[model samples]
Target: MKKPFAIVFLLILSSCQYFEKQVPDEEALLQKRLKEINWKEVSSYPSIAECDAILDKELKKQCFFESMARLVQEKLDLDTIAMLYPEMDTINVQVTVYPDASLKFEPQMPPDNTVSYNTIAIDSILKARLVDFPKIEPAQKEGVPVTTQFILPVILDVE
Candidate 1:
């Protein structure tokens, strides 16, 4: 009988993991994934004005790099992305990348369950751009990988 109860607890614990929305070590995972990407080629990105303001020119140079430093440091910004888009199903947010830029977007405007089950189709969009940082290819660096991160301001109003 004790074995049955123990088994139930194990099953419950396993199932509970599915409900967890945040990714553990997201920056580490981002870094790991970045290694796989050949960002030498050009990709489209949004204008920089749309991203968060860290206005001092010198600081802007390291904003994305600094942001990811949180992965190494103890700092974190939680529940911030979800606040921007409430209905987004954020299991794995798709990040769109371009030369010198990257955009983070989630599923926008799900279906109006009451009005129709048509499955309203909405898509992810741009995050931001790099005006100061020139698009440097991996080849140009002669070895160093070049990548940039941006947090897109997705306009989500429940109107």
Candidate 2:
């Protein structure tokens, strides 16, 4: 009776190890699949009020870009700047739209390009743009609001 009981206990312990081995592999595969997905690209881009009515995905994207361009052009005062460099024809503005619908814009110089402008003037211009900033609906990934980066190219055609 003692020998039979010992054999059954050993069999039960061995089966548990086999079940444990299967779990790790399944867990590891799940982790790998999650990492493979790109979280940056969302199902839909962030929208302004002007883009809210657009149902088509591609058209909505275009409307978002156009609305952003119009907003910047309408607010930034180009006439206030006195260009110190004749070669600089463009300014690249990088704006990070937060999940809470606030924008943080900064002027960044490209690696191969040069920018010559007063910081005070640029700050004032950006401040004016923010005054007219639209109420933003942030980008969503899997139905959760996400922060997004937008780059705008402003042509400096100062006469």
Best-fitting candidate, scored by TM-score = 2
lDDT (Cα, tens digit) per residue for candidate 2, span 17-91: 877664557888989987986875887788998889999988998899888866775555354432544565666
Which stretches in model 1 have alpha-carbon errors above 4 Å?
A: 1-55, 58-95, 100-120, 124-145, 153-155
**TM-scores for every candidate against the unseen true structure:** 0.21, 0.67
Candidate 1 clashing pairs, residues 3+ apart or interchain? 43-99
lDDT of each: 0.39, 0.74
Worst 10 residues of 2 by lDDT: 77-86
Cα lDDT over the full model 2: 0.74
Clash-forming residue pairs, model 2: none
Candidate 2: list runs displaced more than 4 Å: 1-36, 82-87, 110-115, 157-159
C-alpha lDDT of candidate 1 relative to the true structure: 0.39
Q: Which candidate is the best by lDDT?
A: 2
